[model samples]
Target: MQLRLPTSIPEVQECLADGAVPIGGATLVWAAWQRDGFPELAVSLRELPEANTIGAEELGAAVVLHQIDDRVPEVLHRAAAGVGTGAVRRAATVGGNLVGSTLRCLLPAAVVLDARAVVLEPEGHFETDLSDVLAKHHLLVGLRWSAPIISGYRKLDAEAGGPPPFVVASALHADDGGNRLRVAVRDGYEVLSGTVACAEDSADVLDTLHRTDLGTLDPTAWETVRRHVTELLTRSVGG
Candidate 1:
């Protein structure tokens, strides 16, 4: 496999045009290496300074999970805090977490925040809704969001020392004395978003999920999800 260490965004783009897979943090990359060997052409985004920026409303692609801080939104900070242990968090990245795996705690949180991702695609670059971060043949440049969002997130794991099976996140935006809400669920494969107001909406979401991709999820998991969503909504909306 050929390795590329580009120092600037343009150089990174050029390397990518040559078909190099963007690699950040190498936390997930190393894991993939264990499972399927190195990709034929890999480009390291580490040396590109643009990929490491972090702020209240933006986080560059190469920003490590440990770099997220008090300046970021509360829901996102909470999810980042729960991603992995200290050592693992030190090596995991925001972009890699999005592009490499849905199980990463950041997905549902970012979903609820109305996160916008700036991606470097083979044709060019574009920014779009965070839910579509999985666009094929794209490398995430950063994530951005509107300011002053009220949100909440939860990761549900039934067993101690086990991976969380479900993650719930909500964002509430106030405009003209009313609230616009978005609730997101991160399961094993993809994140689901909805505007959940009552028990019926929750029931529909569960039933739909049951009949769809996550058909094998135990009934208890959906029950727990319902309770968890209620708690999140009650707390966020009431406040």
Candidate 2:
């Protein structure tokens, strides 16, 4: 019912301490409010400059989805490209996408990239894994991660441009003599993740992926998806 616009991170934190729900773009918040009732105190982070900026180390939470598609890593860009329509993408914030939704395209991509979220708590700001932050109801301020050597994302959808029932993202990083391949799958409410060493056998990587316990998908269907994802990763790694 009540709205407060904060211009700085400290002000945003103070508002949060006062029990205000942080809002960015308000696409998700407005939808929830329309379905249910509005919260007692709502804080708008739009006025904060840092919340809207994208930098080398961190991406501001309030940065719009389209900007992320343009400026972030290729995996995140691919994920953002699959989000909503152009209008919705223009209005949706990165933080909102990360925090408001459960089966989102970006979360799995972020997971494969080993992204970390910088959150604002009542105590102070702290950096934590993106998966951990998603598990808890934390106030996310920014996201941080180092770019990988190669990354790819694919979503298997029933309809064109619609949200897919299953989404997969893979990232490869040079580790000693071999490469470390990380794959993550987002299937409805369940997230399945696995890592394997891509040294001599690529089939071994696929086998490790099949071994992941994706609770939402059946074994047969998961095998099919795993094959497709392995092909995608192989092409991305140019191997």
TM-score per prediction, in order, is: 0.77, 0.85
Candidate 1 stretches greater than 4 Å from native: 34-36, 135-137, 160-163, 188-190, 196-239
TM match of model 2 to true structure: 0.85
Write the residue-wise lDDT of candidate 1 on 1-239 in tens digits.
88898887678879978989778778767866878887889997777776777777787888888888878877788888888679978988888888886466787777767788888765777888765667563688888887545777777755665655677776766555555566667765566666532333445544553454334445765565566656655666467
Range of the 10 consecutive residues with the lowest summed lDDT in candidate 1:
196-205
lDDT of 2 by residue, 122-222 (tens): 67888997867778968888888877777777776666646456777888767788678777888766778877777556676776666665434677657
Q: How far is candidate 1 from the true structure (C-alpha RMSD, Å)?
A: 4.5
The lDDT, on a scale of 0 to 1, for candidate 1 is 0.72
Compute the lDDT of residue 231 as modeled in candidate 2: 75
